[model samples]
Target: MYVLAVLSVLHLCCSSPATSQDWPLDCTARKTIPYHSDNGRLFREDDVWNYTTVILREDLGLIVLGTRGVIYALDINNINTKKASVKWDVTDTQQTECTYKGKDQEIDCQNYIRILHTIEDGRIFVCGTNAFNPMCDYMNYTEGQLILQNDQEDGKGKCPFDPFQRFSSVWVEGELYSATSMNFLGSEPVVMRGSPEPIRTEFKTSWLNEPNFVFMDHIPEGANSPTGDDDKVYLFFSETAVEYDFYHKLAVSRVARVCKGDLGGQRTLQRKWTSFVKARLECPVLESQLPYLVQDVFRLCPDDDWNSCIFYAVFTPQMDSSDYSAVCAYSMHDIQQVFTEGKFKTPVTVETSFVKWVMFSGDLPTPRPGACIDAEAREQGIQSSLDLPDKTLQFIRDRPLMDQAVQPISSRPLLVKKGAWFLRIVVAPVAALDGATYPVMFIGTDSGSVLKAVDYPADNAADTFIIEEVQLFQSSNAIKILRLSESTGHLLVGSEVGIVQMPLSSCGRYKSCADCVLARDPYCAWDLTSGQCTAISSAQTQAKRKLIQNLQDGDTSLCPPSEKAKMINTSFVMGSNVKLKCELISNLAEATWYRGDNQLAPSDKHHISRDSLVIPNAGSDDAGMYTCWSTEGIAGHVHRRQEAEFKLTLGTEDPIAPQARSASKGLVGLQVLVVFLSLMLGILVGWNFYKGHFPLPCMQKQRQSSIEDSQADVPGVLEPLHCTEDKTTAPAGNSNNNHTDLANTVPVDGHATEESSI
Candidate 1:
């Protein structure tokens, strides 16, 4: 539990910087025509049932299915043109007499019968709910619909008859895998794809009390097989926690898995459900609400590096109360071990101990092809079941981590943590445009707004989570997120109104334009001409400036200490452009630009960058301290770089900044004025004290001198000027002595007062 508590703690870890000026969440990048399947919305009339499921095809086009069961192939690449804004109609194949087509359908072509479809191998596989008609009919036997054609009860093709049923289908390795459970009559959970042979797992309950399949995703390859180890699939569902006269009080979240080869075959008899372990996922805050319902699970697939095998799910314990919801996550590797080892043998419910989890160090390595090591343990000749120990998988189950806080339902676009093991991404809300994406996140809102973001630390989690509306549509609509190509960095987003495409290179990426210019990250960076993020030559400028800074201070070295240790000090030729970046740490610090020994005038070129000095278009003439000092912001602070000489001697060039005489004069005058004011204040204080008002110990001598002169000096010595009352009390000896001293001081005319104060 200590490991669990510590792992759950969310630490503020710093990562890389951002690179681009991302689009606002609500701006619509592009618009695509949405095709609805039926005349009315799926359930609500106002809510035009547009796309419900969307996936990018292998060739870069988009395949989306509307809630009304209308399937469309949006030619994303053709529609997303940069300069031209034109309208194009999407090709529809709904009118054909295809399998799963509605029966008694008038030529009006408006009846609702189909569900959704998965695209693969140049053909579309479709399925639908037989709830209204209850009969699976209408198929064109020749086209090979590949789905919705099961003949278990009779040779005629039809899906297992079950209403109130939820199903999901995905194409894996050119074949479709459908996860479906029966509520009307069947006793087992089924995974099929129109094959007569179906893989089944028995976990029966009442008809109305049917279980709901929540989510499914792929796991790390070759880690949990007996002989032929392959990538496995994960399924999340809310099953019975306890059987009773009435259905169980709560639906418990459970995890299940099926191998690629085990999809549709004679594996029905053997309950070889690899990861069929049940766990009670409970959020203390959400468990006490009404109509306790499980929040939908969102699956994130890794981009390239590590296989996190992580799945995110949000649960609203009181389904009736939307506010009381908590987001919970679990790892598939952990679930696999719990089932394979048979640990914690108990029914599922929302309890803390139900789903044991683990976190891997970095991302899990992808498995090799044709790997069957995990699948060989069950064979009689196998030496041991734990022959190839997957420490990474076991590690995740033992020390799983969870987020401490749950974000709002429609937060920001989904963003992935840089270097995070799982394909982690954040989805958030934008203004109106449904959503946008960088690479990792899918951001959208329940209110028809969305933001798609990748984990670029510079953008920060708070900003990344908010969906920036890329393009606003005319009406409110739900948007689907898509990352068209990582290599090209194209984001394709589609809403009920239209489709949008944007090239997101800047988001959370580069720390500064100089950094981007140096690293050549294909993201946002400094452009001299336009002064914006654009494609340009970055290395030449970065290298020259880096060389100059290294020669001067060696402190601006971007390389780590260990790497710098191996490098030899060197110099390079100055190119056409260079940048001098001077960092001022304090907010109050003012940076002054200088060339050579003379201070340069603060010009447009000598500007303060984000906490640093930027020589926008640095030329040989513009070399130098570019010294930025903090004189007053945080008082008495002086940060000066004296040897900051940019020795730019052209074929024949004289010093340029005799022009900055004004800056130099101003600085010197300020210093002199400060000194003069101090002396004047001292003289005024001395005079006041002699008159017996606000007297100071240090001015006592001056006061005594004045009194003595007033008494001793009468005609030539100075008269003893005194108050009328004090004259009577004045002694003859004191008066005479004061008059003499006053005579000497009077000749000076307060000269002594001025000299002493100075």
Candidate 2:
């Protein structure tokens, strides 16, 4: 087992800076909006519990939040506007039993509302992990209020017993299609649909083995097909691969489909899906065979054009610990082609050791195994799935996986982030000023920040620009959910504590045309008429105004010339320091100072920082006109723009007077004469010490006593001034002569004090 694991690990390893992904061009949000309370008071952090689920009611202009022990309804335009709320709590008996099972009474024993699905007639099917025993109900919204209809429905199959486990649900025609575990331990993962003759996937490793569902939705295939096909309920999830030969438990991304009109088969697949088929969703990695695991998925299908349906998903590596995440896109046409024409994969036990999964190349049956009851099947006397032959049903039950994998659009990821683990995604198609439709994606990350990017699909090129990243939460809490409001052009983001609503585009944040053009956001452009950066709408694009936008390559030729700061003349005192200021607002530009076309060198005399240039000990040579130039690179092209300029002069304040100059000359002469006199006095003392006098011995004794007394008070800066108190009694001739020589020397410079002891 150890050797096999090592070999499997060596099979594929993600290379740093992989060529399969594009380089992420980073930008930051110019403005951020945070949540506030509606009652004109600061919102308490604990007022709202963990936001587990969200419902985007675009029709009713409301956004509903499912939290612990309560559900809130707020205005879609403003999340701070609380419309209504409904509280639902569990009993003490249920909490006590939950704690007895080794769960925390405060965290796990509380009701964490997880399921919030919009039903018909302004009603929502709500469910929660009610203290380890799931319960569900319905609630209606009318007249700006949410009222509970009932709480009697058992939520075993509809909601997961563990609140933190992964699951997903979608409602179509009053029946909820959910993918979750059925038991408390959550060992059995199933894709169950609500009543009106309910059916679920088979509880087998080949069917829905250890799946973690991220998204589920249905598409009306009957309306689009000319042969009267059944509608499809698609599921996007990740599960342990049952068709691999690897040693480790390899997780593969899957796109599963089931017909909505199907019922259980007669003899085989009893009360289980007869048309269940799943295929691996492939996202090509550079020189690697393994695909990334699906974390979240968003389906964008236009109401006017159903054939233009696309599925955007977030993927992360299955084995690595890095925060490596990617975004991949798929079209509905490719997904349908794979499911309709793909081969079957069947498992074969080899050598009585392990099961090896291989593609089944044998001939298929008439009225294909997993085909919905279409016009061709009806012609073969098959009106419903139950009427199919037992051989056909058995073939599909055993071979539930399709051989051909569903590849992403352009056969690669749209965008990849090395440092961000994307948690949720919402994409909106915005019309650019160039008369083309671009998809703008708002992706949430693990650092409480939201990244906004634009995808330009031109000439079969996958050019993406990360326009901005906005921090929605004050704390470092991961954003759990994201919802886009088309009516109000607002984005609703949810973290652990609160939800905040912000506009999709804040073009006003860009103060200059150059800054706006460098952003490359599809929704923003520079207007020449108003001299302001404004949001570009479809109508504005149709009008064809003087909107300066360069999505393919950032071009600023049409922008008006910027006005550089006027040169201000200033005089600095001699030997004083000066700093010249050059303020700029461009984050992507580098500022440099120049003096008369020669770039200033940063040395001991001149220091250059981010916003200014400092000159220490200014001199006449340093006096000159200086200019600050900003160099910015946009779309692989570099451009220089002048920001500010200044003129400086290094000079004295005023000229000296004639009388003061004369006084300074006199003082210099006096100092010179004092130095000459001190030198003569020292020479005379040396001559006296060389020739000893006769009768001056009596005078020498008196001088020695006087010198000894004065030595105690004299400073020791010139020579040895220390003497023993009994030196007079032992008096040596050398010691007396040394004291007499010191007394003859006179002090100079006058820096020494008379009252000092050595």
Q: Which candidate has the highest TM-score of all? A: 2
lDDT of 2 by residue, 311-400 (tens): 999887776643467788999999999988989898888996888889999999877888899998898888998898999999998899
What does candidate 1's lDDT look like per residue over 547-645, in tens digits?
111111112234322111121121223332334444432223345655545555556766544344445544555543234332211111232322122
- What is the alpha-carbon lDDT of model 1 when measured against the actual structure? 0.36
Candidate 2, residue 637: how far the Cα is off, in Å: 4.1
Worst 10 residues of 2 by lDDT: 35-44
Clash pairs detected, candidate 2:
none
Give the TM-score comparing model 1 with the true structure, all chains together: 0.42
In model 1, the Cα lDDT at residue 158 comes to 25
List the candidate 2 regions with Cα displacement exceeding 4 Å: 1-45, 285-290, 537-546, 565-595, 598-628, 636-639, 644-758
Clashes of each: 91, 0
Candidate that would win on lDDT:
2
